[model samples]
Target: MDSLQPILNSIQKFQQQHSQILREASRVAMISNYIPDEAFRMAKATENLTRQLKIINSDSIQKAFDTISSIKLDLHLPSFPKFDYLEFDEQRLERITRHNVSVGWTLTGDMPINLYLRDEYLDMEHDEIDKIFIAFYEEDEYVQLKTLIKNVKNGLSEKWSEILDQSLDLYLEGRYKITIPALISVIEGELSSIIGSSKYGKRLVDEFHNKLDDKMKFLTIAAYSAYFFFDEHLFKSHDFTHARLPLLNRNWILHGRDDPSAWKKEDALRLLNTLSTLQFIKEIEIAEN
Candidate 1:
């Protein structure tokens, strides 16, 4: 056994060497696995960085976008579409119209208020609505009316065009009695055309308004007194036609009971504004259908 000690020591040394070789191999295998994973992670990070750089590589492009965002672009937009030209919502428009009621001018939603006036118009008082609304026609020397007639009637001598011409001529000559009734006939005819009914009186307004959405109905509310706020202002009974400034009654005007003095250029302007509003209704009807 003493003689075999050297041999045993040699065997033990060989075992230790083999174990060290196995440990080295295991470590190399682990390092090989770690190197691939670390390289893949680095490749992914580089790809993401490249993508980010591509998106914002041009400082000038980014700066141009920033500059455009800072600017306002509203020029040449005066005759913009109805929705675009209308700066206020239905509620704001109603509030604006109601502002005129203080001056004995019962402004309904039918009247096309100058929306571009914005704060200047809304902040006004003391017959300002009339000065801005009705006077524009007089100031423009009925050129506005001529344009409006063209708009409401696509072609001459069609759908109240002849009568409209007659009314305008009578109005020009100060024959308001002739003009007002003729204009009233056109208005009633326009309303009848919209409602697809023979007549538009009393409950017919409600029926006419039924075809409109809340926003579109704002136009009706803006029209005569009979729409949203039915009252004696615009549609006073024929028997009670004794009148004032805003009391331009449809029944009174139509039945020959209204004051002849009530029909003036201003009244003609208002009815024309109403015709424009009805044109809006016609547009809405076409769009919805």
Candidate 2:
């Protein structure tokens, strides 16, 4: 209805440079220890291109709003918080213990793979109920684990959509900064409720949320991961992490200035890509389980 054509056209313009975008995306996918080095450099270059374009078309602000509104997102958003962050069920902890698996990792860790593995192990234990760890742990069992994760993820996806819708509304209404925390609280509550609803879902979701809360403790930071994409237009360089480069680039490019670093697009995107890829790896590991 908003003539998605303009937004689509802009994305198409960028898509024309698909080769570069894909390269950046690839680098982003494996920006972690798993990927090579040459691609990292290329990602930086592409990121610069995005930054320059953003600067040239300061009007990109409008285009961004228009494009975002035009897209037919499949995500299901959650509702606004009934109360404040103080109202969330912070007392509750994940049902899964860290000792259940051999990885010496908890279900709650920054790397989603860790949670994915933990979830897989939990599902295995759940199905067998009495089998010793040695007998149940195997490469093939990953399929069942993934199925369980998918169930929880599907439920959470509905929540993600809600979070996005609320955040977008606040953003469009010019209340983003002021109201974002409330939206984040809603997101946390939704995830908490979903996790607590099912044994398997609770195990996986709690593990993930606990880890996130430990590190950042803010729902807004974690929620941003669900929808944020890479924006290569900011910064000249940054360090590395295990994330998707495009998404990282977009995050830093869009918000890096809010950080004191004035972060380099090249470095930030590389690191962000690594982190994103790691997230994907975690998803894959969970899916496989």
Candidate 3:
């Protein structure tokens, strides 16, 4: 169910170009040239070109079928024009060309073989094919989300795996009510693990805050002043308030006071991203140590 649009587009472009060439060749074969050998040469070239074109057309059709089949979607493709008539016509041309090329070239009885080309078959099926690609694009997003969750889970301790798995499973199953809380639990679990670690604990937080302050001070005076104002009114105040408020501090979700209906998919995703960030930071710390 991966994207088939690229392949489909390529096939369409090839068909358009091929059809144009076939039309020109057919026109040339029909022209009554004064030079008899020249007419035979054009006929011979057109016959060989048509044969090659038919093979290319057939192969492209087979490719489209193969791609559709691989996705496991039950889509019916429209019937393509029969190549049997074209093959028979090509064989007749082959005989004509062989006779003309070997002996004296005969331009008297030569006729233009009308090559069958249908562009409408693809046009009719284009919408259905596009729908399949749309579905595949959604499926691909879900797959990528799952992969990110899996990577974050792997970076965590074994105890947090259940929380991560349960949250994702519920999310996928459309149980958003339960999925939000489960995701919240995963975030809390990862945060607790990091803060409760004997080697890193609250001391790491203190060091991180100090480093952040030092970095902020090194900015230009105007930038530092703006950040200082933000720090006092927004960042530090929010941190202090968040630390004091039980519900805002994750107490309600942890203690089962938050409404499930109020939670959203974006909230869950943001929490998951935070957990992923924490996991990345932990890995960096481990590497440094």
Candidate 2 TM-score, C-alpha based: 0.22
Q: After superposition, how far is residue 40 of candidate 3 from its true place, in Å?
A: 59
lDDT (Cα atoms) of all candidates against the true structure: 0.47, 0.32, 0.41
| Candidate 1 C-alpha lDDT tens digits along 51-128 | 221121234223323332333333221221111213334455456455554333433222223332144556776556
* TM-score for candidate 3, residues paired by index: 0.37
In model 1, the worst 10-residue window by lDDT is 48-57
Rank all candidate structures by their TM-score, best first, as comma-separated numbers. Answer: 1, 3, 2
Model 1 stretches astray by more than 4 angstroms: 1-90, 100-126, 155-157, 213-232, 236-245
Q: What is the lDDT of candidate 1?
A: 0.47
Q: Estimate the TM-score of every prediction.
A: 0.55, 0.22, 0.37
Q: Which ranking of candidates, highest lDDT first?
A: 1, 3, 2
Pairs of residues at least 3 apart in sequence or in different chains that clash in candidate 3: none
